[model samples]
Target: MTNATRISATLPPDLAAFLDEYQETHHLSSRSAALAEAVRALRDQNLQEAYQELGEAQRSGQETYPDDNLDGLENE
Candidate 1:
């Protein structure tokens, strides 16, 4: 946490309220921490989906591979 940057953002009322509630419930120091956790969760979800797809392709003998960055095929 030696380096940090500040940015401004706007959110819908519902989303803003959710962040506030999540911060308080999780005992996060700030809404920024809550938002960071949300983003990390999303990244984890995307990775999980990509790995599932890769496993499925392997099981089905599709012989296709996911991209290096795990973006997978766009047309699927």
Candidate 2:
């Protein structure tokens, strides 16, 4: 099943131009595809940062992970 939603967004001229350039440089089928790729990269980067924080917290001997219980993780 495809999970696609349509939405409208307004971008400033410079950003709009950049988006066009990005779209052209990447040879994407459409602006939506370029934006999707950018968003996916941003999401992956954010996840990596969050995971790094979690690992640091675990190694630092911090007592709690508010969003995680550290359950089922074998000792290093």
Candidate 3:
């Protein structure tokens, strides 16, 4: 299992209500779990964007990749 970290933040009333509903409907244990999942999702999105930018740079000849096969791996 992955290790976890604790964090705290303030949420607007509407957002808090939505989170509460989401937890109850999904049978999630706590607000921390929901927030952790949200953070992971956001981090993944950022990493994907960086990967896409690198791909674009390589395609435009602004950056060079070490191996041609690595280009195919990006799509997979």
Candidate 4:
């Protein structure tokens, strides 16, 4: 059984063709898998940028988000 949910999307002509070619060239099982990989890559990039911003804020002594009891929660 698969854990994927299906949805319909309308892509531009050029992007749709590119996705099809990429799927074929990389031997992915389906276009859905290709799209999932692309989204995961984008998410990783955004998360890295966010971590960098947080680190800079800490270094510059700027008040960012609340530093609640997060370390305590990790042991629970």
What tens digits encode model 4's per-residue C-alpha lDDT throughout 1-76?
1576788888999999998998999999998988887877787787678779888998999978565723222522
Model 3 agreement with the true structure over 1-76: per-residue lDDT tens digits = 2666656789999999988887888888888777767876787787778789888998898855445434323632
Q: Per-residue lDDT tens digits of candidate 1, residues 1-76?
A: 3465787889999999999999999999999899889977897798788789879998998977736554634523
lDDT of 4 at 15: 96
Show the colliding residue pairs in model 1: none
Provide C-alpha RMSD values for all models, in order: 6.0, 6.3, 5.6, 5.0
Alpha carbon lDDT of each predicted model:
0.83, 0.80, 0.74, 0.79
Sorted by lDDT (best first), the order is 1, 2, 4, 3
The TM-score obtained by model 1 is: 0.77
Which candidate ranks first by lDDT, i.e. highest? 1
TM-score, candidate number 3: 0.71
Residue 26 lDDT, candidate 2, scale 0-100:
86
Per-candidate TM equals: 0.77, 0.76, 0.71, 0.74
Ranking by TM-score: 1, 2, 4, 3
Candidate 4: worst 10 consecutive residues by lDDT? Answer: 67-76
In angstroms, the error of model 2 at 41 is 1.2
Clashes of 2: 0
Model 2, span 1-65: residue lDDT tens: 16789979899999989989999998998999988888778877876787888889989998557
10 residues in a row with least lDDT, candidate 3: 67-76
Residue pairs whose backbone atoms clash in candidate 3: none
